[model samples]
Target: MKRLIATGLALAALAVPARAEEIKELNFGFISTESSANLAKSFEPLIKDMEKAIGIPVKPFFVGDYAGVIEGMRFKKVDIAWYGNKSAMEAVDRAGGEVFVKTAKPDGSSGYYSLIVTHVDRNDINDLKDVLDCAKGYNFGNGDPNSTSGFLVPSYYVFALNNVDPTKCYKRVVASNHEGNLLAVANKQIDFATNNTENVSRLQATRPAEAAKIKEVWRSPLIAGDPIVWRKDLPSDLKAKIYTFFMTYGRNGTPEEIAHAREVLAKTSDGWGPFLASSDAQLIPVRQLELFKAKVKAENDDKLSADEKAAKVKEINAKLADLDDQQKKLPSM
Candidate 1:
């Protein structure tokens, strides 16, 4: 029977007609970008539900970080995965992945913020400049280099602009995932860190004491939501079923059904309330940020002669401009 895993957990009475040769099993990759065990636990109920809805045995493929997940998709070890925009770009470029949809916040917004945070009791670290002033003495908790908000945003907006090399400035700098960073900051293991709004919100709800101990010092602009990526060459029918599993979840269902779906989603600390169909274009904004950072670095290269630097910066700026124009052409999510 075709059943949409919508809200309140009511199953559809009829099933989507099966194709001539349907996939009986699939490997769904989950990036332990945060806490692998915790993230996997949160998805357990939904994974089972998805398996039942799609009438296939969906295997959970958990990996250490974005790179592993991307490489897994590249090597065909993963059929589908959830990816941040930057890694999603990698998946598309190197892994033959295509974005079919993205997860949305409970308010239906398709974005979240990347924040600079510190211990609530650290009155001396009240703001960005303070963090920099204390940089030489403080132990820093930085995001993984591959992370978009964790690494890319802070690198582009904070360290690069200020001409500060974190590795040199901080007493000790530890690269950790969002969950690790958050916990480190909360326990005073690290003096400062970067975390996303989604995880922060979930922490506030699920771990109030830890959340209360952490405070946002600064935050980046809205980052496009995470995408559900799949191998581009997967058979169309299988792709359809996979798409249906997410897109149909929490939609077009009775109140009880809707509530049930919401309940299941609640377990995922990211406050994901729905899945919205999206395209690869959703990544253009972040890609533009990445390009802008490259331009910044190229312009500041001391090894290059003035003329050479100017020429390189000009080339990068042109690409940024093209992406900017392309971004404007896409519908606002």
Candidate 2:
């Protein structure tokens, strides 16, 4: 009887499954929206705070492009990350990622705008139309392919809606981050470039002289604030810890501690305050925008057969309708 009891206990233990490996550390991947040095300086305080709150070592991962961060999360090398909506969508779709929270502006607003900026001294280029006049032979600096405000917004509103392909419309086209594009235009390194209000405001605060050199020619409609994502498979306890840390970091603490946390967050990006609880549903509008862009492209493709164009547009419309339904089901933010 004793032997049988021991055998049953062993079988039960096996059926229960071995415990998951403990998480010793977390690697937070940061997208290259600015120089590595600047990003490091801006985020160090937050990283340290996160380490203390989570009781684990936290490391910052920097890469040259947005896709690097997405790939990092996909491979489980990056446990968490900050991502713009478009890239966050990519991560959610392809990187085993899930949105947990999003940054909120200091003013309590939840969105920012995309911008087209040119040198203040350039009188010739005054609007989207001026920039789109391909005959003028202007050089352009676009944003990272994965950037929401930088690439996707302007690509849809400024280019696609006008039936212009940026690659063929400009004398030269260069792709870089928001800061890079802003500086390029300011210095006349490029005639115009894509940027966002957040980066512009950041520059104004950090480098007023540089900020004064560029002026906006176009501004897109407001886009949702950036989201913080984590690998979906992270241990539930670890996810809870991280969620608590972000939700409370700046909202609860000693007076001075809260002040310090707010200050650190303000310096990071777009002068944000405490994070707000969010989910992958925040990406619905962005997904709709993507589909709309695809629909427009299909409509404009002269090479497509009439039947092919109809089929493409039909497929895109179906996807957009599904997304609209999903958005309707979500509670109003």
Question: Which structure among the candidates has the greatest TM-score?
Answer: 2
lDDT of 2 by residue, 167-205 (tens): 898889999999999888878899999999999999998
Evaluated at residue 280, the lDDT of candidate 1 is 86
List runs of model 1 lying over 4 Å from the truth. Answer: 1-22
> What value of lDDT does candidate 2 attain over all alpha carbons?
0.88
Q: Which ten residues in a row have the lowest lDDT in candidate 2?
A: 7-16
lDDT of each residue in 1-333, candidate 1, tens digit only: 143323212211122243476566888887665677787778888889888887889888887777988899999889898888888888998999988788887677788888899999988888789877743588988887668888888888887777777887889989888888999999999999988898888788768989999999988888888888988767666666677778877774789977888888766756688788777888787788888888878777899999999999889888988988997888765
RMSD of 2: 7.8
Clashes of each: 18, 0
List the candidate 2 regions with Cα displacement exceeding 4 Å. Answer: 1-19
lDDT agreement with native, every candidate: 0.80, 0.88
TM-scores for candidates 1 onward, in order: 0.90, 0.93
Q: Give the TM-score of candidate 2.
A: 0.93
